[model samples]
Target: MTAKIIDKHCAQDGDLRPQHLPQNSKTRQLNLFEKALVPQNGLFIFSAILLVVYAIAPAAVYLIAPVGESFLLLSLITICAVTSMLLGSQISLFDSRFKPSAPRLAIDRRVFIAVTWLIFIAFVLITFSTAPSIPIWTALRGGATSNELSQERGEFLKGREGAGIALLYISTFLVNTIVPYSIVLLYRVKSSLRHWAAAVFFLFCISFMQKALFLNLILPLLVFLAITRKLSTKIFLPVIFGTVGLLLLTTALSLAGEGGDTSNTRSSDYLTALYAPSNPIDYFIWRAAAVPIFTATDTLVVHSEQFGSRPLMGATSTLISSILGIERINLERFVFEHQFGGWNDTANSNAVFCIDAYVNFGWPGVVIFGLIIGLTFRWFKISTDIGFQSLWLIFAFVLFSAPLIGMLLSNGFAYMLLHGLYIRVDRHGT
Candidate 1:
């Protein structure tokens, strides 16, 4: 029975050996430090610490160092440190006990392919129906100005009421969730048609001129490859170069479309500055990490009375409000408005997940939120252990991991539903 299972996996993975199987009676035990360093938990722990450092450093410079003491900075740092440590400890503990085994059930390939094509076709139809003359290739290159694209997107969403709105949401969900899963599956199966399907899907998504959609698709694919030990240097290097090249091309296209003079020198300078970091820590803090923490701290100070007054709505504000027949208070939007006066049309106007929690509750909320996310990551790690032979598990882990640094619970429910439906143990196999 063991030999048969090994042969099956070897056939699927193209390389396996009997000696590679886990010993039945004497499985290798990892030490506490080694256990904590497992990739699934360790990466998140490192990220949380990095976020804390970024969050506290600027405040420490401005507040703590000058006067030698700042209670606010000290309190913020303590809360953040505690929250990160709690998360790390939870994740580490969960992963330490996880025992990997072969998957008992395989994906329903026919159903997966059919659903992918149907969704892709729906997306293509929607894009054309909404804006026929917008060349997808041009949009993919970022030739359309942000203003122009935003106006077009508004037109697409304008008058999408009742069933139309519902259909739009369903389509968006499929594109974001199932489509990426399908791509990963296709790649794993070594399907002859995978490349063509991926190209069509990429063009369709890039038509909207949203860089996130591209990253949302590609990053997961890369991570899935890396986790499965299938990522070759040839594939990895090209992907890196391709991503950088795409960004440069898109930036050039956006600059070209602007009314100002489009000079190659300006474009070159932009690329140089982006790659050649003078102050790496400061650059990362300013660009990525500090905004969320700063926003949360500002909220705590400016709107202390409102802090912790409401339940932590996470990401179900709209659904909950709809069901209860109440007005949905968009916490992120409220915070953004408070900080910047109003939403900026050309910029993404949402706070980080931590800030969202802090605003909804307070420091307690941050700790609870961290614990919940840590547990979710642990759940995925354990699920992967049980179904290590399944591509669906890999896809889920990659997809969920992408949003960890930014918004932890935004798509939490949707992902949970997907996992429940598709990734289950096979009673017969067991």
Candidate 2:
């Protein structure tokens, strides 16, 4: 009965086989593709819970830091947990031939590891060759007046135009992006890692100075790969527990910081800005559940203190200034200034697009945006023939790098749209 129920839940949604999956035992594994075909009630409830939690947490967090942040943390945990289980099962199922073997080799697969490694090396070289130089004057400008400028200087102390710097950034981006993607392709194509040295050499060349990018994306992939290398199950268990502990601790710390200033006066100031509700429950009721229902109600119409137009204008104006041969232009600064009045608020936490998308179009827009993102993931899975061997590392690379790069560039909407569009469907597809 339990098995039947599980099957029903798995069958409730779209294609269950996500391209990036981890290897495991067959009898115990939950193959998302095959399981997706079976009917199951559990998966349906699970997905619903995840989608609901994800959709509701942000609005709730806006009202009370501890309460809302806690919920958000839980939601994030749930997503990762369910995704890992489902993906791992599917990968294990597909690699049934190697289920009993400690170390499996794919002799029949067409996507040889050597070819993928070579392609990745070529990509690293291309990235280095095409990278544009950062302006020296931009680093030096406004250093005396603003402390922010001093930190920016520290970030660019290495100087941007050097061949060494270029090689570093190129190699880092390639390792984080191309190498992992190639690993997925190689796995799906069932290839051997005979050219691992060549691949690593190219990665070393490309990753010289781009330390931040490497940390956020490439490191995660390496960590995942190391954990599951068929060496020791004991080590893998500790690593998993450690990772979860770290995530929870980080999330708790983040919430604690947000809760530091819980003054009523400050709350009042936030309330004034809201033009909506004061409490968490009321805020959700007002914004999500009520506003749409009472579209004709005049009191429900909230006027934002700041408008989105100014940032749009500022971004464009800065770009125009650069084109007109201006001495030093920082488009990000201009955009932030116009959009947020240079405030140190959460509004500045991520790209303006994350907030602006809603400010412009509201909840419907948010849901549509999420659905589009989900579809993009589906497409990425379909187009790529990513194999089970090293798929986890690849997924880690994609998941971490896409968001990190997106956040850094402050291209929230663009981040969602472009990453979704560009992540080729098959992990190893043509």
Kindly report which residue stretches of model 2 are placed more than 4 angstroms away from their true locations once superposed: 1-24, 31-57, 61-176, 185-235, 241-356, 359-368, 380-384, 387-430
327 in model 2: Cα distance from truth in Å? 18
Q: How close is candidate 1 to the true structure, as a TM-score?
A: 0.65
Residue 336, model 2, lDDT: 36
TM of each candidate vs. truth = 0.65, 0.39
Report lDDT (CA) for all predictions.
0.46, 0.33
lDDT of 1 by residue, 171-261 (tens): 4555565666666555544566667767777766666554335654565455444344334455556776776566555444433445543
Error of 1 at 57 (Å): 4.1
